[model samples]
Target: MMYDCNLKIYQTLNVQSEFNIGLLLLYIIEGSSNISINGKTNMYKSNDMIVINDLDHYRILSSKKSVIACLFLSRVELDKFFRFNKKYYINKDKLDLSVLKFYMNKLIVNYVNDQSENEKQNKILEYINQLVMTLHLYRKLDGTIISNNIDVYSGINYMYEHYKEKLYIGKVATQCLLSVRRFSNKLEEVTGMRFNELLRNIRLSYSAFDLMYTKKLISQIANDNGFTNESGFITHFRDKYHITPAKFRKQLENDHYYPFHNKNTTLLRSFEHINDQIKYLTDRDVDYVSIDINMKNKIRSKISTPNLLIYIRDIETLTNNFQQSKLLSMRREIGLFGLLFSHQLFYELYQSNFENNKLVHQMFSFSLEHQFDISFEVKLGKNQNIEEFTLIFKRLLNYLTDCTYFYGQRSFQFYIDASYYQFNRISKIIQDNLKESKVILVLNKQNNYLAKRMSHKVNDNKQIACKVHHEIDSDKDITSILKNNPSLNILYQPNIPNRIESLISIFKWSIAFNQNISMIIDDTWLDSMIPSQSTHLMIKELQLNKESHYQLFELILTLKRLRGDIVYFNGLILMTHYLNEYQIIIFPNMKIFNRLHQRININGFKLGEIEYRHHDILIKNNQLIINSDGDTHQNMAEVSFKREIGKLIVQFYTSPYAIKHIYIKQKIN
Candidate 1:
């Protein structure tokens, strides 16, 4: 059998190939070859890395078809590897060979494995390293491969593994066996930034996840991720986002809305709110109605009539006393009931009833053909977080009554057992499970006192989520909310759509032409999130059934893949698994400017977002005019996920891209 100077030509390169004394230095340089380094005899594209030393025979074949780069270096070059491996061992498996993932992700040949020239350069290095290792000299050198550089390929691995915890500079220091000073210098050289800067970037990245995905509080976020106080958190958030935490949160609230079929307020409650239950599902052309809170429903009329009424039931009151009875009857009739005892001032009571009347009018009026308007404020003192309510709510109510002259108003219908916290808890249980969670609904029955008491504290926005605090809802109740709101479109894929084929197809094709795909993983932010995987797994046995669980597992795995993408957002996504496959371009979980989705080219050269010229990146108002300068399209996209407050983390897969666009708008003239 004949072999080329390059590690080339092997006819029997099957699953059981073994390495000879000096054959580890072989690299297939040109053409194509069937070289089985492992049990898989997969095709070797141009620049694929083959690292298998455990095979039975290192057969050499003269392939008119394949070219090889074999570096059977003279004994001296083999000596250099000994010196290079002094600080870190030059084992074929752990460091250079098995770190296939590291190389695949790197820009060199891993993610960019399509470049045969790069593959050639890497092959040359492999040969040289093998020579150095064979003579046992590369293992002896203390600081040879650029004295200051630590094996960064492994540092990233550490960050991926430990990013969720409070990682100290010292801990990373111990991993490298370098002094703090040495570590800092070397890290800067390898990572292109200082230690603190890298850490800040990590924090900022984590903040994005929190902003887009979790229900955690701002202050809690600070504490959970190792910050000492709220000020530190606000400062960090403001610095990165150019806005305060509250402001960021408000913006996020505008992005996601849950259609409320909420039983407490909707007046039309019976059914559960599902994606397919939107009103506009039947008619997409109609405008959505929102009852404006401004107009007051006056009881003024020349003719006598029963003007208003209220009803409160299912109560365990302090007493079935006459005073309680009197208050309940008046509030039930006059509409100002919640104001009298609510806070001593009754201002919020007036405000709430005013909005309630507006909603009532909208629901009853059919001639209202325009868009609706609405706003609401729910008091927190008596409902949720009772301790805080007791202190803060009591004080606020006193302030309302004392200075604001809200005292002595016989407006409220109060009950001893009424409280907001229990309302939310029971209501949420009922609303979420609909009919199937019967056991949960039954247990909730015992907590009716808390539910009724807390019910008034909730405000359903009517547009987004109809938050029924009901533990179980009938279809009719859910449908009523949809029937009332006739504008928004609704659709649902009730069962989890099988996304496996889509993912596998992407992987296979990503390797073929070497698609450019990138992934960025952010573990720290994922850790701080409350609803976690480990918890869900534990709860699955207690709460969920088999089919429901399979979908959950699929979702978790999908998230893990997404996390992997988030970690290395700025670089190449290396696919080093299964026989040194190939390279591709990719951008994982980057916050691209929502408007610029299609306007820019999202591959190659520089990584970032872009802005288009003359046309809105997204069809804001339609007229999309093509720019002639073509070159004016700016490069890159904006951050993918921006705000964390009030944002719901739903699952969806979007194609990641980078491109150029123009920034033509310059404020005012």
Candidate 2:
């Protein structure tokens, strides 16, 4: 029986009653509408199309000024289409119909004009058939085929519900009222998997969920997921995922705690404790040199100077007021300064602010003589016009590139303050620029969506740096970002809690994510914390109280455990001064250590037996003396210590060059 195709145009708000007869296709050509299918709501914008199947109970809520073209295929027509092409069916509700808009418009025009000739009617039917076929072909091309048979649906539902049970194919076959052989063949035919394989896959998938979301024991997870034992589960998981379940969990934790820039880059979460401790040490004017056993040898010939990071608020004011001689003198006093400029300040200067330009040129000249890096901080919200901003930024970067080239230095970097909405729009531009030049793109406190997007675009050639401005709580979001982008250089803000537990949490998190982190300490905060002291007895007066000592020790230990770098802002001078006297060196984690051992094969460095303990650790003669926390010392070639010390002295161990390439390769895996 042939049934006519019905076409209706919705001009304004329109409601369609729930139906289970015909296959309905609603095309929004001019505007948008909201579609609800079984309580699940999705918005269909302009040039969007949605297909509602006979089985799907749906309602459409059209916009006030929407132009919707609705076409219905009667049950007879749907059945005839399915009989010939049983494997092809519309699976997705919403589809971007921009490509089909022309064809659909023609069909709508013909239907509205109502030319009732037989050929015209046949052409209308052909268009309807063509639309359905296109929808089917598109789904197949996109790998979105839906298993529509009732037996397959029921089997999948039963498997999902009973995946934890140790059930055999016979049991499922019995439940489905089929013989074991027939059931196996039917399952394979319907879902493209043998019954056992399907069951195992479901169990494995669920086990992964438990491993990531739950802190359950591996044995417990194995048992809960119907695996015979932990070893079996581990073997299966490793076979499928190429990483141990424990590593997966660690990765999840790391991604949760850090912001990922790319597969190889992650931003460490901010820790207030480290910052407070640094502030405390700087405030007390603690004599870090005096505590060092090698102070006389390291500091006797050199004046203690911290690394400097200078924040340039008004380059115009500085350049206008100061003489070049003064600028040169100021440059002579500082070492390794990082000059920061806000997006607005740079934009103004590039707009031909003469005084600012002069200041910039002078600064570059000073940097050429003194060796300092220029850091541009861009806040995305400030630029209302992203396209315009991109153009301006490109010009500024080109100018900076030229300036750096003239000065024979390449230390110009960008710190972008991005959010979800802005990053997506500018990601391509950023990626293109990254490929064309050598510049570090520092993303600060980006949302999950932007972070994920940026992470996917990262490659080995690009230098992507990520900084965490706040804590992240969503494990799923974090894990997704990290799983894709692992080679992230994480920068942690030192404003997080200072508790040992918190520090340990951060350490474990970093290791799990398999990324290196750096602590960004603000020099302004450090300087404000210090008290005025005369140069005469400064060393004697600069003493840490017991609490300050404990805080500093904890902070140092935390940094060491995480193998974290310390980036001193304006306080680089003070940091360098202290660093000269004492170094806080962290041993690599066990996984990293084994890799190092295999690659470096350094004398006295052994793998597998090394254990990290916290007790009395001493640094003397460029060697670490670790007091065993256990009663007897284990036969280990290397050991790490976590301890509270009165006179702590440290020396850093330079990592093997090969270790970096190995580390990056490991992360990629």
By lDDT, the best candidate is 2
**lDDT (CA) for every model shown?**
0.32, 0.47
* lDDT score of residue 200 within candidate 2: 75
Candidate 2 lDDT, tens digit per residue, 1-669? 011224555555444545333467777755678889756899888667677754355767765556666676544344344332332335453343532443465565455443556666666666665566555543432223343555554555567668888788888777777788987877776555787776776677667667645789999999998999999999988776667888877765233321111232222223232344224322331111111122222222222112233445565423543333333443443323355565676767657743345557765566555565656667676447877777776766566656656776654555556654555445555445443433345654445455555656666434455655334532455556656667666555444323223333333455456555544433232221232234653443244221132342334333432211222111101111232122222332211111111111122111222222223222121133233232322322332222223222222221211111011001111
TM-scores, one per candidate? 0.20, 0.33
Single out the weakest 10-residue window by summed lDDT for candidate 2.
Answer: 657-666
Worst ten in a row by lDDT for model 1: 286-295
Candidate 1 has an lDDT of: 0.32
Reference-based TM-score, model 2: 0.33
User: Candidate 2 at residue 368, lDDT?
Assistant: 57
Q: Candidate 1 lDDT, tens digit per residue, 496-527?
A: 22222233333322233222221111111111
